[model samples]
Structure formats: structure tokens, C-alpha cells
Target: MPDSAPPPEFGEASHEPTEALEPSAADLSRTRTEEAVPHTAIIVPILARGVTLGVTTFFRSRRDEAFDEDDLRLAEELVARAAVCLDNARRYTRERAAALVLQRSLLPHGVPPQEAVEAASFYRPADELSGLGGDWFDVIPLSGARVALVVGEVLGHGIEAAATMGQLRTAVRTLADLDLSPEELLAHLDDLVIQVTQEGHEADPGGVSGPGAVGASCLYAVYDPVGLRCELASAGHLAPAVVTPDGTVAFPDLPPGPALGLGGLPFESVDLPLEEGSVLAFYTDGLIAAPGAGKEGLRRALTERELPLDQLCRRIVDELAPSRPYTDDAALLMVRTRRLAASHVAAWDLPADPAVVARARLMAARQLGTWGLEELAFTTELVVSELVTNAIRHAAGPIRLRLILERTLICEVFDASSTSPHLRHARTTDEGGRGLFLISQFTRRWGTRYTAEGKVIWAEQPLDPDDTPARTSGD
Candidate 1:
């Protein structure tokens, strides 16, 4: 039989090698086997959506009998069924490829180096036939040598889940920058998920709706290097595994609220004091919940305390799921806590008197010089004076000034009052409004955060290289 023939609607082409086929010698040669032995054959072209994919061939020895009308009809029916199946498979393959691409693009490419916590992550999408699912993790660097570790999963598979994941991840970064507490961040995230689900339904009534729509779980945590503390919150997600420096594993008690978009209840945050060198792990349920892998396996995988984080991740992947293709999307983020030493931080109490501003400035200059940050002395001294003066004037007595030397020179003023500071442009006639304004000009950035006891107004100035000379002078 010929591999392909003219459309049956146009009058099908059939060949009996015992007879000469039209289109002459070439047609006969193509339809004939290399042996050129006489034979009778029926060739049926397989068509999909009006395009010819290939052909189905049925050959019979010429001596037996030529193909009858009944036989031809049967061959046509078989090829018709095969064509539809092939077309569907091709479409599915294309769609899956696209979904996987979208999912990968939505995930973080790499974890940025953080001084507070060393982070490493691993992610694997489900096998192709299973479709792509939404699984994502992030390491967001926050102000004051703090980092936010996140892992989230959208409920179902394919492009919709991946898209929803991207939306949630973006919302997290934005909220994290606002310095929202863990519980507060999740609350805002829940609101966003509700908004997304509503908008998705309104925009596409038949698309992206139903049970799995907008259902997701997230584990959000913020780590502070100076305090060696982690504030964690979860939204119907798995509890994290914490490995102490001595390799003892423990899972902290944290409230896991209902999955986002479903729970209107307020999320609660837990404060965990992470010991120095403790390893904290955040992951989607797939890693531990997959068949044949249990929480025990996760603990065992993490118990290899001697391994570096990257190797530890590989070890976990190999031990937990050695299969080539994962059945569900899996993501794991491991962070090792590193505390800041006293040598890097300096704090002192300041009197509420104006005369003490010079003393604060002098202390700041001496500390900056000790840290090989003389280039920042002239600028940092003015910043300390302003922040302390403001705290003494606008806030209460027993004010405190703290200096932390990390990637930047952080000058903070702590007071007994909860009043937050605002930055405003000082009019030329005003002598008072310029404290914050001048501090703003000399520093890279500044902001205020409230602690349980009081509020701390902090300013950050980029630390110049040791060899670099002073960059600014007092105003």
C-alpha cells in the first residue's frame, strides 16, 4: 500500500500490483515492496484536522485474494481512530511543555546570599503526563540583616496553578518589604487570594474556577540575625523541621490556619528562638506526603548533619524520592541561622538633654573608626545625633542608640514610646522639620519599626570600602 494517497472524498487510490497503477512507474515503485513481487494492497491515509499525518497499510499476497470493499472499509475505520488519538496526544504534549515553562519562570532563579541565614533550595515539577503543578520557594532579604523564607503550593496542577503561585509569590515580596509581621503578611495574602479568585471567576466564568481554584498553602518566616529569632506563620501548610547544631531534630509548635481564600480567621505568628547553627527547613507537602516517603524519611534525610546544605538537599532528594520524575511538584528550602556577634553591634543609653547629642555623635564616630568605617564617620555621626535627638525630643526619656555594622551602618534610636516617625520636607522658614530630612539626605534609607517595648527609628548608610576616604561632612 502507498504510504499516502489522494483524499478518499476525491475518489480513493487503490493498487493491485497485478495491475499497472496510474501516475505510472513512480507510483507503482512506491507502492511495491523492494522485492517487487506481485501483491494486492490497500493504502489508507490517516488524516487529522484535514492534514495527513501518515498512512495505514494492509498487504495481501496476490495469490490469496485482492482486497475487497469490506476489507477497505475496515482499514479506513482503524486509521480514523488512530488519527484522532495521535492528534490529541500531540496537543497534550504541547500544552504540558508550555505549562512547565511558565512554572519554572515563576520560581526564583537563585537564592541571594544572606548574612543572617544561609539558604539553599530545590524544586522539581511532576512528571509530564501528570501535568505541571504550582510549587514555589523564595529567600527575600529584609532590612536589618533579616531574611524571609517562604514555600507555597497552589492546590492543583497545570498553568492555572502556576499562575496563581506567581501571583502569591509577588504579593509576599511586596508585603515582606512593608515589614509586615508573619501573621499579618498571611492575613493580607489571604485577602489577595480571595480577590484573585473573585476576579478570575468574573473574568472567565468557565475557566479557572471550582474546588481547587485559589486554594493554596504557604509557610512564611522572618529571621533576625541580631536576635537569633524567627517569626513564623503558616496557612494550612506543613510544619517546618528544625535541626539543632547537635543534629537533634524538632518541629516547633505553630498554628496552621485554613488554606488561603477559604479561611476568614486571623492567622497567628510564632516566635522561635533559633540557636546559632540551627538548620530550619520549609517545604511543600509533596516531599513528605508522597507515597513511600513519610515524615520519618524527611527527618532521616535531615539528620546527615555533616553535609553542606547543597549536598544535604541532594541527599534528601536521593533518599526521599530517587525516581527520575516526581509525581507531584516538590520544593524544599533550608536555612542555617548565623547570629551576629557583639563586636558587630554597639548600643548605649542617651540622656534626654540637648547637650548629650555631642556625646552620641562622638560615640558614633569612635565606633565607626573601630569598624574601619572612617569614611562613614562624618555622615554617620550626624545621623546618630539626629535620630537620638528626635527620640529624646519627640519620644520619652531613657532613650537608647544602637549601631549595627553589617553590609550597611545601621544607626537606630530606641525610645519608650510607640510613636512612629515620619519624614517630611522642611520649609526654609522651619528649623525643626529638617532632622529627618537631613538624615534622609546623608543616609541610603531610613524607616521606623515598633518593638514590644518601644519604637526604633533606624537609618542605613552604605558602608564604603576600608581604603575609601570619608564620603560626606556634617551639615
Candidate 2:
């Protein structure tokens, strides 16, 4: 071959024999002595969509017959077929790499520390058959020392599924922030999926496309450490496996609602008490979908409690998957519950009167001193006085003040009114509207939440002594 020669066009073949060919740098491997040289050879350039990738060469030994046009045509046909496959292989490699990066970015990088439960998760994408199947898990920290465990799997694979998984995960977090129960959260998520499906159908008027829009299963649970209880709801997902502290394995019979995007059916939520040190496993179907073994096998595997939660998750995955690479994505999230003891909390009911404000302030100071948070006592006392005064002045009777010692010092005032308190700025002459304003200035954060009984105004102050204000009314 010579550099001056134009590259071969489509359906063209070039033939060269050892006697006519001029030696080149790349042809050094083929160069041989006259007695050892081949009689003739055929070269066919592999073309994919008008682009030449490489050439296929065939050689004949000294005794073999000379290569002819018929042989060259056959060689061209074979290379043409190989070219298509080579092109597809290249495309698939590029897409898989992009999908892997997208999947990793969408998933949670690390679980943040929470006071209610210890969580660990493992995710393995189906790298071979399914190119980036959508399987994801997350540990969301909620208010009141509670944490939400989530696991979801989008039905199809590739970039579409990964994108949908991310969308659903984001929706779940937004709903969780609203302090919605598991049942209510999924209901909202189902509606969101319905909207997405409609948009997909409109985008492709002919029919459904792109992972079939909202074909996915999700399991959501919120665990409360105060009561050691977990409320669970599922949307066409497998029941979670719960291993008790005493080694009892049970998959609470939770109602499996219809998968998301199906509007006819309603979802159900169940509440179960999980004692301290109990192991709760939330996973997708891929984890337990062995050839013959199913959820029963998963239950058996989860019964072993000697290993740590992180180690247990890996062991379960290794045991259930076959020797061959996975055909579907798998994700497992394990949570070990830890309850706050009675000593960590203090509560008292006070009459709706101005006199009780003094008593509430004393109680807050005493509790803070007991918990070695004396430095926060000045601000805590001011917050307690303001909240109690507001409850007695504007709200109904049966007011309650509770103090919780956890990662922070939380003071909550429960009243029998549903009115939401907002932080309003008061002018220097405004005498009555400054209660909440004063409380906000003294605490790190404050908010109000409604309960079945009434609304509770809560404020959180940093436990670190350095975070406490240097000057106070008491000072």
C-alpha cells in the first residue's frame, strides 16, 4: 500500500501478491524471504456508514491457488457484516459509559449522620445485559428524630430509566420535607408519575415510549426513634424484611399498592414497632429474584444478625446473585433502630396562665443544667418564657412544654390551637408582637408543626457552649 493511493470507497477491494507489493514500515511483519512468502493476498477495507475503520487481509501459502475476484467479493461481504457489528459495539460502549456516570451522580453519595437510626446501603447496576437499569436507595432524615428509608427501581434500562429514577427520587425528598406520612407521600408521587406519563405520551403521539413512563416500584418507610416504630407503605414493591433483636425474622404483611402512574388503585400504609437493635432491610426485587429462591430466601438470608449492617448488606447481595453477571439492577438499604430513652426527654403540662411562664423558664434552666448545657440556659430560658407566654396568651388551655436532649437542645410548647406562628418584625413601640421575635433571636432555629391535638411551636439551640449568646437578660 502507498500513501499516495486514495482510501478505498464502498464495495471496493484491493488485491496484492508478495511479488508485486512494495514493503512499508507497517508491513514489516508480513515481509518474508522469497521461499517463505505467500503467493497472493486479498485486502478489504471495513466501512461503516461511509467511514473506513480498518481493513481485513487474507494470505495464501506457496502451494495454495492464487486469490481471485470471487474470493475478493466473499471477503468484502464478510467485512461488511463485521463493520455493522463493530459500529454497534462502539455506540453501546459510549452510551454505557455515559449512563454509568449519570447513575452515580443521581444517587446519594454518602448518608448523613442521624440520631434516630444507623443506615447503610449498597447498589449494583446490571452492567452486562441491562445498560444502567434504574435502581436507587436513600436515607432521608426527617423531623422529630425520625428517618425515612427509600428504595425504588425503574422498569426499563438505559438513559431514560436513569433520568426517571432521578426525577422520582427528587419528588420523594420534596414530599418528605412536607412531613407527609408514607401513604400520603406515595399518593403524591403517584400523581407526579401520572403527569410525567402524560407528558411522555404527548411528546410521542404515536404511542408510549422511553421506559414506558412511570413503570417503577417504590418502598418508603419513616422510622421514629421516640416510639421505636416504623410506618411503611409500598407501591408494587416487595415487603421489607425486619429482624428483631432476639433474632426473629418477619416480613410484616404490608399491602402492595398498584405501581406508580396507575390511578385507579389507592395505596396503604402500615405501622410496626421495631425494637432497639432491630435490623430492617429495604430492597428492590432484584436482590431476591434468584432462579428458584424468592422472598423466602431473602428472609432466611436476613435472619443472620452477627455481622454488622454494612457487612450484612454486601453478604446478602453476594449470596442472592448468580455466578453470571446480574440481569437487573439491585439496591439494598439497611437501618438499625436506636430509641431515645425516657431520661433523654422531659415534659410538663401547664395551665394557660401568665404565672406559668415563670415556672416554664425555671424548668428549662433546670433541664439544661442537668444535661450539661448550662451555657445555653440563658437563651433557652428566654425561648421557653416567650413560647409559654404566647401559648397562654393567644392559644387555648392544656399547654405542654417538652425538652428533648439529642444532637441539639430542643424546646417544644404544645398548645390547643392550629394557628401557625410566623416570625414578624415588630417596631420599637409594638408591645405585644415581639414574643416570637425575641424567641427567634435567642435560638438557632424555630418552627411550628400541627399535630392531631394541636400545634407545637419548637425551637432548637446549639448544644455547643460557644454557640450560646454572651449577653442575656439573666446576665
Candidate 3:
């Protein structure tokens, strides 16, 4: 019997092998006794990524008679049509998989729990045909300032669109690390993109396609935990929602600004406040673009659900990520805003010996005691003691320490070294090399950064009483 289903438009053509129905005379007799036999049958293949994943078979009985040659021929046509549908579904799956992998690499692995606030981010590509669009998010830590944030989307789809997203996101981070204002940062990025495009044209001897790539819509924001303020710039981007504790909130308005790549235009920055017990949501258009659902649908979802920004972002996908997964690429970045009484002091050019670190720790403890944070001071001293002792044993030159009292206790150590601290399991006879591991096991989070002069090792401890009280040392 001929196979039932349409020919698939897969990259490689499919050659189906025909097989006869497997029914013995005995089985046929059983079928006859039960009712009759199938006069018509249809077979449909379930495909994914251009491959037939599974098949669904259907049959119809006529006048209680068994299926014959004519009926089998009709079934073949039905199966042919099924193949086309299956192939299309597979193609979409492939596109989504590709976009997701790329987006994951671009975003941070995951943000650790922060003080006085929570953060969550997500990214999904548009329908498979649209490929990956330019929607991105970033959170940057500033020097004695606030967390810099950005969410943006380019205006196209496909491989070119994906490339543009990558370029713009990288530029945003570079400019942010330089401590550029939102307006100034975007301006530099705008110029860089145009410059790159022009340079590409110069490099291309042969004829190339259209102008490099158009600019994108972006929301640039800065959240200061101490000041309880959020400064943002909206460039042809959607309004960000401000969710309140009572579950009643609205999207804040902002001064208009031109999208990136638009020449002869200027952009404005808007600053706002993040009150206690409030959630602020920043997302791309995909969150509002479900079929037959518009802005109202989004508004209803956010308001009625009373979900915080982080949870809201996940809800958008978990609850409404298409009945059978999305057809397009999509991405989202959300943060719950809050205020905390936090302060940090980083002093350099201090002695690198153990005694200096002891003094530094005492100094930090006194400062904390002055600030009515004696508990934090004790914890900070313990952390500094270990870090400084290690530095004294291994490196030479000056050391620095940063004491930050936020919702958590954060102590940072700076030494004239680039080699990362070691964290290893030690025996009773061993005397060293467990500082990093011990801190990691005890603190809420600990990491090292490559500073301009040397390196900075930092650790955070939560003040929450519900947290685990166990402790560990360098190993």
C-alpha cells in the first residue's frame, strides 16, 4: 500500500518506504466478529526539526466491511497531506532551539539573590520564520553607585536581526562599564553601529545588500538601592509597569527619544522612584503580542494577577507561551525594585601584611559600630582577617578592603595579585589554601573581579534569620 501523507519540504527530500498492513486472517476474523473492518484509513506523521518524530493513524469502517485497494489509495492521499503539516512544525522547532541557545549564551547564567530586591530575566525568539530578533537585557554593577540596566529590541528578524541584537547588547555593556549616562551611552552605540556598517561597506569589494542594520528601541535604567531611585531612558520603547503592594499600579510615562540609528535626533533620560513593596516590570513587545490579544490582555494579566515583576515575567511564558510553544522568538527582563540603607567604602594603598588587615578589620568594625551595624562589623572583620592573611602569605604590595552594609553584609578584599584564590579540601596536617572555598561555603555569595590595579575578592552574608547558620573555612 502507498504511504499516506504529503511530501515534506525538508532540506533533504524524504523517501518513505511502503509496507503492507499487518493483519492475519485470524485477526481479520476477530474484526469481522466485533463489527466489521476499516474501509478507509489515514496516517499522519508528527515531525520536529524537519524529521518525522511520530505518527498518528486513523481508520473508518464502511458497511462493516474490511478495507480494500481503493480505500488504501484514498488513505495514501490523506497521509501525503499530513507530511506537509508535520514538516512545517519541525522547521519551527529547529528555529526556536537555535534562538534559545544563542540567547542563553548572551545573558548571564543567573543572578544570585540580592539585598532589598529580586531580579529575574528571560529571552525567547519570535516565531520560527521570524528567526531571532534583537531583544536583550543587562544588569551591570557600578562603582559605589547603582545597578545599571537595559532592555532593547531591534526592528527586524532572521540571522541579520540576531547579529544586530548581539552587537547592540555588547555595546550597551561596554558603554555602561565606562560609566556613561544612558543618553551618552546610547549615542556612542548609535555612532558605533553606523561606523561599523560604513566600514563593512568599505571592506566589501563586491556589491552587498542594504544599509548595515537599523537602530533599535531600548529602555536604559539605573536602580540605586540606597537612594531608592530608578533613573531610566525610554527610546521608542514601551512604558514600564510600576506594580504596587496593593496590586494597583500603572505604567510610568517618559520623555520621548529617538531609537538608535536615527540620525539628527536627541534622546532624553527620565528618573523615577521605586517605593517600598513595589514591583517594576521591564519587558519586550513579545510579552504583549499574543494572537488576538493586545495591550489590554497584557494589562489585565499584570493587574489581575498581582504578581511581582520577576514572577510576572515567568508567568508570561509559563502560562501563555503559545498552546504548542511559541512560533516566534521572544525575550523578557524583569526586576522587583526596592530600597535599602546600604553604604560601601573602598580604601587602597593600605599595608598588605597581616597586621594591616587586622587594623583594617578593626577600622571596619568601628565604622560599622558607629553606623549601628555591630553584627555586620564582626562578620566583616572575620572575612577580612582570612583574606588579608592569605594576601600576606602570597602577594606583596598594598591591599584594600570595601565594607558595604546593605540588607546583607558584604566585605571586599583587594590585593596586588591576579592569581585567583584557591579553594580545596584540606587534611588535618594541611595549613593553607582554603580561603575561597571556606568563604563560598559560609557566605551567601563570593566572587573575585579583575580590578585595574590588581584583583578584588568579595563576599556577601545574608542578615535573614531564616538562612542557614552553618559555617566553613577557606576549604
Query: Which regions of candidate 1 deviate over 4 angstroms?
Result: 1-97, 128-131, 199-208, 211-214, 323-327, 465-475
Q: For each candidate, what TM-score against the reference? A: 0.78, 0.78, 0.54
Candidate 2 residues lying further than 4 Å off, grouped into runs, are 1-90, 128-131, 199-204, 211-215, 323-327, 425-445, 465-475
Per-residue lDDT tens digits for candidate 1, residues 111-157, read 77568888888776665464456888999987677889999998777
Cα-lDDT of candidate 1? 0.79
lDDT of all predictions, in order shown? 0.79, 0.80, 0.66
Top lDDT hit: 2
Measured with C-alpha atoms, the lDDT of residue 386 in candidate 2 is 85
Model 3, C-alpha of 327: deviation from truth (Å): 8.2
TM-score of 2: 0.78
Comparison by lDDT, 1 against 2, better one? 2
Rate residue 249 of model 3 by lDDT: 62
Q: What 10-residue stretch in candidate 3 is worst by lDDT?
A: 10-19
**Candidate 1 Cα deviation (angstroms), residue 213:** 6.2
